[model samples]
Target: MKPSLYIATALMLASTSGFAQRPPAISSPDVHADNTVTFKYYSRTAQKVSLSGEFLSGNHAMTKDTSGIWSITVGPVKPDIYPYAFVVDSVPVADPNNTYIFANERFKRSIVDIPGNTPLVHALQKVPHGKVSYRLYPSKTLGTTRQLLVYTPPGFNPAGKTKYPVLYLIHGGSDTEETWTKVGRANFIADNLIAQKKAVPMIIVMPYGNVRPAPMPDFTKEVMQDIIPFIEANYPVLADPQHRAVAGFSVGGGQTLNIGLTNTSKFAYVSSYAPYTQTEEFQKNFGATYAPNAEQVNKQLKLFTISVGTDDFLYESVKQNIAMFTAKGIRLRSDIVPGGHTWMNCKQYLATTLQGIFK
Candidate 1:
């Protein structure tokens, strides 16, 4: 109607449009100098909130303050990276204030890093870094294009005359290809290990191991047929079995047993970490097809190792597998450590594998 009246009304509306009523910013996963961590979550209407993480023995209840913020400070935790989540009224949720996440298909958890005085193997250190590249490859077995991550060692050159060994690494069930690099910090571990001359420079191929809706066993086919050929063709890696290795964690670890043991001529190094072998495919292969040809398999494989944490749920099964291999006169190295089935142990297993493989 009137110019001055319209301007006055616009200003009045803008002032009441809820911008200034926004809640204050909250910081979560605050790591203290003493290695203790403070986790915070903002919720006013929640009945209860609790914290669950690898660092703690059990879920710890969080106290709510007047500002609708629920928080708990736990641990002078042993300096390492851990995945934690807040259970708000029985529902697990990632910290809204923390951006670092645990890369998995089934969990929405946030990551917290408590740095040690010395850099952890998975920690980013002042060393020559490797490049993690995401690449798409055609999966003839799966009948689609799939994505995978490749970690090339520092100073990698495509046209260079030097060729590197290849490690076909796989992730756990419900974990994506990026889990190895993102959650497990495989690239950083490799960087630190290579810089220290503990491990040789090599190429690592992390492929998506889930082929659900399709038979779970088909993943072994994809890795053997599609993924291996793609990496060998594209990267300057040695193609022979002597220079090729296969390793994985959880369900992927079971696949490692299937793919590596059944095809011992293809993979010289087979490292399975806390493998979940209670699968139909694992039984079908290890029971029928495997037939305990331990002598021949032992001859073909240069290194066969299985690692498991004592507190892992699958520890008994893994120990049984180790015993079976030992009884069959197959040479195997067992790395039994203290901890559960977690990415923390995965990093330890990988660091050890890097040191042992391709030597």
Candidate 2:
């Protein structure tokens, strides 16, 4: 009850609490000057921990230390945004120490941005950046409330009279509207291109492109009906075919070929990256319409591009697609690169396609 005695007791308790056991320190993701990144996962009870990502060879087994920390050093990775995760005891998990995250398709992962000596096309350069926003709209065809990620280019003012061109960018199978921006880094690519004045400042709209198992209404219905109407009414964008473009990867690439080719009057620029479609399915679906609309479609469409990697699963089919359509008295542009059906190639395809679209 005495003041001095109570103060001494409080000090002793504070010392005990301060000296109480504390969490161990972490030395994860040690970035070296040579660009090699070493990642560490400390777990005293885990049986196994491995690292896999946009970097490294598939999955690399990390070495465990005496202190129960698993670690691996990979790359000299080229300066780019890479997503990686640590698999602990057969469960895939993001690194807890990393603050940057890129999530899509309902799965979240950690990201690391390695800066290059000079800015890459996909790099986020020091320039006026754009704004990415989410707009939830009612999809009457799908009978669901769908979300779309819209990117307005740098210096975009909705009130101003400057109306920008629009690009309806679509995502692949098992991916959502957010995939293009989050994982593909489409916004930064667009920002860099616009800053360099290689591509025009345009409004990019990324929409979900999965409507599957057949007999179901194709997503093209929603794309043509709900999404276009919403973007046109809300944003300061050009509303004509001359200022509109459509592009996607994988399944979305197929949709691009189907919708953009079939509705050529609506989209002047169309690009498909590693589009997945069987010849039989293509014939059953778009063949009849393609033959009849050939002249009109060709007349209306300014640019029609198809790109696929050499190692892509859809490579042969895409080549056949290019050949089949070209033989159908249609003009086509095909870009075959050196990679597989991965996001790495998709990003490059996007960058190249953007530079050519509005020009």
Candidate 3:
């Protein structure tokens, strides 16, 4: 064969050989019958890969096959939504093959939901789903345009005569206004609850809880002034204390206590889930002021509740707040359940609060 023939043969082989072939199939988070799941990642160059998530007992090393694909099948993960990531050689990254992801400012994670055979609280069902509206309005308090997410329950019609109560649900730190309905499944929960007649149809208001130029913004001021007024003016809501509730998780939880408790005349039902508070600061400022007004708050408050996980870092601090309020002769309801400051427990607390509120 001449040199030209040889060159043509080499080019044909390069085009048709392994370089053009498709790699092996990767089945990430492959669910099994016994409630186990197999997570797989294809990485030919990585020296190590470890799986880290709420499902495992810390970082678990993945086993590599002959094809250099790292994998791990963890047994019997509980039926819930979990966020996981792969730390390939110490750098964390979401599963490239997985599209479901959770939001976080510092870390990226791939979300997996091990749904029960039946529909869970976060799972979608045949029930009538509510409407989620992303509303934008100018915040006079902050001097900026802000976004808020609102959930209107099934059959909610502003033009009709029926007016529903409102729940101002706040999101956690590192989450945007969309977190509650998008990740926490707030609309689905509301839909399911209303369908079963377990919860009254209501409007859920989710606001952007953060502001610039401070350790924190005057969220209480913004919500009380801007967000509430916007909702009342536009939506078919019973814009009164008896029909208004406030609840939140994490930083939003702290805001809930600070704003809702102080304005007892405005919010009838007030609750917090895994609230983060600096005990010393709370005692120095809020505690002293609110302790004196405990009677009025207790009188006007239809439901005053705090729910925290036993294993949460803020558990003891939350207990301290509760103790202070208890000493002030304020009626307080507590849900000290298992888990930590996580969405798993947030959902439980929200479910419980919805059942008992506005009844």
Candidate 4:
């Protein structure tokens, strides 16, 4: 226990701990001059690795070389920010090599900064940016106050004398009112579309679609009893059915169809992106029987557009919905894009569908 011996022991402990605590090693590929960005991960102990995202065709499985690194070249992707994650051995994980992430209500998404100037993805331009205002509204149906996000176009002002069409954009399950604006970049889509003159200047209302403390409620009750009245009373929007549209992704998509069809007089335009409504609960709740008669229900719908990614898990169900609607004499537009069940597909659909709506 001499002074010199004690000092030597302390130094040895510090050195050992420092070496053991080194951070995990991460390696990322360089962006080529041609604008294509490659990504690589090293997991010598991992049995499998794959990249699952909007950019790839079908969750492209990485090729593990003899050097123990898994790699893939994903591009020419359009010039836009894409959120993606790596799945290692059946487990969903974020990219350790990337620093950017997009936040949602429930979780954080790892993002890769893909410049829009690149020929592969949609590039960001110097367009008029829209304003997203977060507000709280009282909901009688839920018996409580709820959050609502309103996206106003560039010149939106309460004192202004302009009445804008409103699009009610709903998020999927496990998401809140912020999902569409935050993760889906609904405001950005609207901004770009309006700037390019592709879509009319409109106000987008994103409300929390999930009925808390209960299983997903019937869209008929939730939309009819809650969302509709709130929009009509609170905003400076057209109250007419022709100026109103309802759209959603995944579970929200199902809600669009369930609520839009049953209450056709409320929403003139309806769009469902990768909607899921084939369960027995959906049938029982919506009274969605397989009817071959198109004239069975009164059709006051102006436009009923259904879009799904080709690789979506609900692809078949969406196709069946299209066919079922057709057999019933319901004339609708069905779009099958080249992607899967992710925000990328939904974003593209939102851009296009909003352009064709209220025209």
Instruction: Using TM-score, give the best candidate's number.
Output: 1
Between candidates 1 and 4, name the one with more favorable TM-score: 1
**Per-residue C-alpha lDDT of model 3 across residues 1-359, encoded as one tens digit per residue:** 56675467557756785675334556688878777888998888899999998877789899899998899989798888787899999899998778777755656788887886877877888999889998899899988898898899887777999998999998887777877876688888888888989999999998888654331337888888898999899998888899999999998888788778878999899998988777454445575657789789889999999999998999998998788789889998988999988887877888888888899
lDDT of each: 0.90, 0.83, 0.84, 0.75
Query: What is the TM-score of candidate 2?
Result: 0.87
Predicted structure 2: lDDT: 0.83
lDDT of 4 by residue, 159-247 (tens): 67888898988888777787786567788878888888889999998888876543335445766777667766766888788898989
Candidate closest to the true structure, highest lDDT: 1
lDDT tens digits by residue: candidate 2, 1-359: 66685467546656685464332556566777778889988787888899988766678888889987789888898766777899998989988677667656666678777766787887877988998999899888788998999999989999999998999998887777778987788999999999999889999999878776541137777888899998999998889999999999998888888778878989999999998776466567777677777778789889999999998988898898889888888887889889888777888999998899877
Worst 10 residues of 1 by lDDT: 17-26
- Sorted on TM-score, best first, the list reads 1, 3, 2, 4
TM-score of every prediction relative to native: 0.92, 0.87, 0.89, 0.76
For lDDT, candidate 3 versus 4, the one ahead is 3
| Model 1 lDDT tens row, 248-294 | 99998988888898899898999999998887667777877666787
Runs of candidate 4 with Cα error greater than 4 angstroms are 1-33, 38-80, 86-108, 118-123, 212-219, 286-299
Candidate 1 Cα errors over 4 Å, as ranges: 1-23, 213-216
